[model samples]
Target: MTLQTLANAALILILVGWIGIRQLTWRPILVGRMWRLPIVFAAIGLFALSGSHGASSVTAVDAALLSLELVVSLGVGAAMGALATIRPLSSGDGAPDAPRFESRTGWVGLALWFVFIGVRVGIDVWAGALGSHLAASTGVIFVMVAANRVARTAVIGLRVSRLATVAPVPAGAR
Candidate 1:
């Protein structure tokens, strides 16, 4: 593996580790804030893919594998989001228009994260065996991670919105 590849792998592990810790704790579900990380990751992925040091070429097999990975990422991310536990935020803790729920992924979400990582690793191995370098590159991994996070955020946002619709409005706010 190249130095860049090693650096990327390390970076990914650090990111996942940091986020995993937060996922197990109760935190306010701020859909807007959730977007920043994915967007940054996507930008980095785009940069890597376009850089000379990254994947030089994309084969048909690479494309197919990437598509497959994307699908799996989305599926797993959605499952994680769906499994998240959301509780109403305490009074006076949020602004009138702020999100009312605090969400935690807990054990189940962590398990899903493992499943996602396992599937990603499996696909990467399969691609390497097929000589699809793109699949094994950092760029592809970043993109896939971004896609997964986006999927999770979307599902969580949907759930939060549903809750908002059904929840009674505070008397003062009305």
Candidate 2:
């Protein structure tokens, strides 16, 4: 397929994946929600790799670049996920359940999700359009998605853990 054809195909698949993510997360949290993004992105990466022809063949440079990008992207995802997961200890209604800060977190996660997608598509296009030998081959997609998911999951897990901690008394109470 032509380069543009491949890019367009990749965009279409990404849009489909994005839509799936939105639909999957629109409802209340479920046991399955946590794993959906990582799995979907990983599956997409695998699909991209399979179609890349000769993806199994890689040079040292490509390996190194992928590794570096993975680490950097993972760090980026973690930082952003931290911002996305911020929540207040309680709600405005004086009820333990009603929450304002918590609601925006889902939107934050969704925004970060699209940010990761943008990075993936931008890098893919750059690598393809330039044909730079230094650029990561198709395998970068898998690593990028893996990095994003791992960091995001870790951050979210940390957020949940923090939620379990006992709330500190306000200064006036002390």
Candidate 3:
């Protein structure tokens, strides 16, 4: 493996560890904040792709595999978001007027994460076997991850908005 490949692998491992831990915790569902990571990741991925593999060099196989990876990522992410447990924080918890929901993915969510990783790795291996290296580029990984996060964020945002409408803030707590 090249140094770049090793670095990319290390980065992926660190991201998986950090992101997985965060998802398993109970954290406030803030849609605005949730959008940041995915957006940034997508931009970085796009930049990397454009720089590393220009349009002229893209093969049909690479395109097809990338599409499949993206679809899988989005699907798995939506599943993870759907499985998340969202609950309203009590007034005693804090900010009674500014009602908020806390979310946790728990073990099942973690398992889905593994499924996502497994499918991603599998796709990469398949791409390598097919000699479509561009399909398994590090840039593609970021793009796929961004797609996954975007799907999860959308689902969670919808859930949070629905919950907010149903959950009223305490009177005079504003």
Candidate number with the higher TM-score (1 or 3): 3
Q: How do the residues 1-174 of candidate 2 rate in per-residue lDDT, one tens digit apiece?
A: 676447555864775476436533423222236567777777777777666654666665556555666776787668655765344434254444333234123555566666656665565555555553334344445557666766866776666556646563242322
C-alpha TM-scores of all predictions: 0.88, 0.58, 0.89
Best by lDDT: 3
Cα lDDT tens digits, model 1, 67-106, are 9999999998899889999887765434665767789999
Superposed Cα deviation of residue 150, candidate 3 (Å): 0.4
What is the full ranking by lDDT, best candidate first? 3, 1, 2
Q: Is candidate 2 or candidate 3 better by TM-score?
A: 3
Worst 10 residues of 2 by lDDT: 23-32
Task: Name every residue pair that clashes in candidate 2.
Answer: none
By summed lDDT, the worst window of 10 consecutive residues in model 3 runs over 90-99
For model 1, the local distance difference test gives: 0.81
The lDDT of model 2 is 0.55
Count of residue pairs whose backbone atoms collide, per candidate: 0, 0, 0
